[model samples]
Target: MKVPFNSKDREVCIIGLGYVGLTLAVVMAEAGFKVTGVERNNHINDLVNSGKAHFLEIGLDARLEQQVKNGNLKSVISIDEVESASVYIITVGTPLVNNSKTTNLEAIKLVSEGVAKRLKADDIVILRSTVKIGVSRNVVKPLLDEAGVEYKLAFCPERTLEGKALAELVSLPQVVGGLDDASTMRASDIFGFLTPTIIRVTTLETAEIIKLINNTQRDLMFAFANEIAGYCDVVGISAREVINSANIGYPRSSLALPGPVGGPCLEKDPYILSEGIKALKGNPALALLGRTVNEELPKVTIENIQLLLDKKVTSQEKLKFTIAGLAFKGRPETSDLRGTLAIPIIDEIKRILPNVEIFGYDPACSNEEISSLGITPCGNLEDVFKDSSVLLFQNNNPAFEKLNLNSLSRLMRQNGIIYDLWSQFDGTSLELSNGVRYGGHGLMYLYNK
Candidate 1:
């Protein structure tokens, strides 16, 4: 196996068999490369070795199985199992340090050490993990340099949605920036085989900022929409209505609808962006502001629910609150719940409300998976809303939109409230029963009054 670079060895080692690494390993193997994936987690390694994906993606499991059976790809718990490889790609998680603004680079550091132990001259080391600026040079470089071996290093970020990783990985333009021009060319040459377009940036820091800025800007957009919702709540209006009307055939003001903005990257990248900016003696005011707004959206929305409940429900003994669409997003539909807004909303509900029975339902997750969120798994649509005090829609799963809520609301307690974060249903078509109310996320004020 030979890559376009002046290297005959096309053996590739991918560290961390998570979403990023696993998808990349399979794709690379499909491209006629002998790929070996390394994961420290026994469970993930076992699953990958058995040709299964731990989480749900559209067509990941089938591709994984084919790759494994063909002997083109395999997963090992340690990199020492591999004799040698021309390319080593690190795709580990760079989660925040104990829910703080700083990124925890322990995974990146440890993987770098592992790659260094098996270091070879002219080997290409690509960092696909999200990190703050200067990490590629300051963190990974020193560790690899200690091996006294020459290697090409680059920062190539992974920018694909959870449910659409495989397709997008091959279609999306791969951004590659390295410590030197030769390193950048080497990375671009390898990634060029995956996608038709290759974005060659000047420096690793430039490539690092691209991912953070893209996600932070998206967070800021949703924050503005949530702020509009707050304004509408105060003035007795609908943020969804106003935004939809404004953006209708209008290109100037492209406003996103108000909803719980939570996913792994969107929830975490703003902090990484601000941290990078602050390190350079600059204030990322807008980025951090957006982060704060999105972070508080769930907590504040739950508080509003508490206010709405206080006026409607009189019985406190057997109160039942149901949550539908538990995943982070519902459009593409996924089972991943890493940075979901459900966590904070549940926390606020438990903290402010008393003795409430919380029911969980998801179109994309199993009952056991829903129970992992610390709520009772709802059997079905009817069971979820049966005698429930409040029904909250967290994500925009199509299952919620197809339901006849008018019939379901008939099963709820009197003055029952259905609040949709994505505003899938138009209240104009809903006919209430027993004083039941169905309202969009931003128009909760209409019913709370």
Candidate 2:
């Protein structure tokens, strides 16, 4: 028999001190548990040990600093560096492999192998990284079972937004699904430290699928809106007007607005869903379809831009282009660049305008980060638009809505185009002089609605 997790005194060892793991560690440490994080990256271990985070999140720095300084939290590069804990949380990255669209489970495999060697009777092991269904059973379980020790395993997905992870971690209902009934109760008891609402599903597979379904549903909704955008583009109608009017005072129709749909979850969850289904010889057309539509957005926008230039109103000579809102999203803004559509958009722009001067700006991302991605880091919104032939608003930052278009038009080259992918600004309301053109993703007709 093992110890019951009836109190916060149970020691915890969290693998992977990245975003998900680090936030969880801080929250749990603050919840009064002794927490140790294991990360392979030396730099990450140092940052955590020194009370700094690898990324930014509201209220994370202060809490992390307190935890490290107060001796409640510490991170190590290996599991062996610390004494065995009663609970283990695996929050490692399960990124997709290049070109395969299949999830790379090397991190999960390695972490599980390490944890298996350290397992004791009734030691709780929770998988928090998003993974394909049955991964907990088919892959991780077999590896851990090799140790021939009794342990509790569960899949408790970390389903929090990047920028708001700290706040959401304490509020969002923690979904717990375990290998068995005992496993479920124990994991549920563990996550109770984070949130009061512990949603216990039937099995580990149920928990895994819930995570995928949540993200995949979001991707599908956005894909539908983007499809509407494409349809409106072809018909020369306004998708924004159609969607807005349809949803206004209509309870049945809660349609999402058309916008650039790119983020870590939406970008890869669909493929992860498809990969899982394929192993069982099941075809997931809708899952893959959502991804296909969302993936086509960058290329489609580039094609539209090329058509604008082919009109010959804007001079191609000495042309300069700028992309603002380079983060994956603007609302719930984050500095994370993973799975951002900005990358594909940049690639498409380069293909059309090779050797063209391209600049990038994002309120959330640093100039050095922008420059590291091969884009010239732009300083201010005015400098981003000054003398620029084209400016693309690739995200939904509300700050873009406040631009003084009439004044900025004077600075833009004649017939300069401003394309807002999220249609953040009401272009129709702002009349542009100096031959400057304003447009957006869904249609040439830009509406604030």
Candidate 3:
């Protein structure tokens, strides 16, 4: 693709300062564009204005502060800024509707409505959020028509991991689709600053489906990993070890270690795709099944704990458990617990053992944040282990790797269970410590053998 516009001089306006929008805006500003971030909430506005990031991204705050101080980035709570921007990108939330496959695109609609009203001729509106396939024409373009504006429209869904978003934005190739050739040209030109390897689809629907398919594929793979873990549990085999050993021969088919696949995008995108298929009068059983398996993992992981502890029933007040890592992914050290698998597992714990004194200790989580979720904030690792009857490890953090068996053994009560979600410690060492009981997705293989 050939660049048509002056990519370096483009004034980029991003709507919604969320994990997606905020990162895109910062990266654009860093890429030498005059970036204007339009936010609706007062709290988000305050954070951005103060040069502080609302969510966790690797080095996002320092980069945002540097760009803001350099006069390259500025945020405002207004749609009026659209008049100055030649490119408008939408990166709002598309939440799931409880157990249902449908998505709530209210944020997308509102942004489309607001951006449509402020559209000028030749200005390109790019939908960066994942939505139903027909959103570009059935929703966005109609709003622009209703506003009586002659503008270009495109869908260039976000394709970056939470922790590596900044690096991937500049390194990964982008998928773009526009209403017309002219629209595609304009979007391609602007995005070329970030990556020149752009794949243009024949229709906006294709672009929308492409993004959905990418996440759907990952969701399915994670589900397979979980099912394999289930089999490993039954056969007394370590699924992680088996997977690792298998990778030595057929390296291409290696899936991520079995864990909860919870995060805003991963958990929601597959449902949206499934819902779209349902609307088209097709049975999306496989997609729905993948979602079910992943969502059920946290509960299943907890169930594995019950069997290991050999406790039929327990009170919450007497039980103290700790979740090691909080962020969905392993890097960038995020504080975003939204749709995090830990939320559901913790909720299940409360339901079964209402009196269990649940203690959450994540280096990324603040006391106020954990308190808001009705959990006691244990700021230190030692506190997490102090007299706890049970310890639950939700994520993988290097801090958990530093603990010695002697240190862990002294922290628990007699015959106390250690629920290791990420296999935080050496299973053999933990089991040999005498008082400690080790349980995880596939820990049975190490000791059961």
TM-score of each: 0.96, 0.94, 0.93
In the range 198-259, model 1's lDDT, one tens digit per residue, is 99999999999999999988989999999898888778887888998999999798998888
- lDDT (10s digit) by residue, model 2, range 4-106: 4455336999999888999999988878778999999999899999999877676788889999999989999899996758898999988999789899999
Residues 91-160, model 3: lDDT tens digits: 8888877856588888888888888777777778899988976878888788777768688888998989
State in Å the error of residue 40, model 2.
1.9
Among these predictions, the greatest TM-score belongs to 1
Q: Please list all clashing residue pairs in model 2, or write none if there are none.
A: none
Give lDDT: candidate 3, residue 92. 82
| Stretches of model 3 off by over 4 angstroms after superposition | 1-9, 81-83, 311-317, 431-434, 445-449
Give lDDT per model, in order. Answer: 0.87, 0.85, 0.78
**Which residue pairs overlap in candidate 1's backbone?**
none
Give the per-residue Cα lDDT of candidate 1 at 447.
Answer: 82
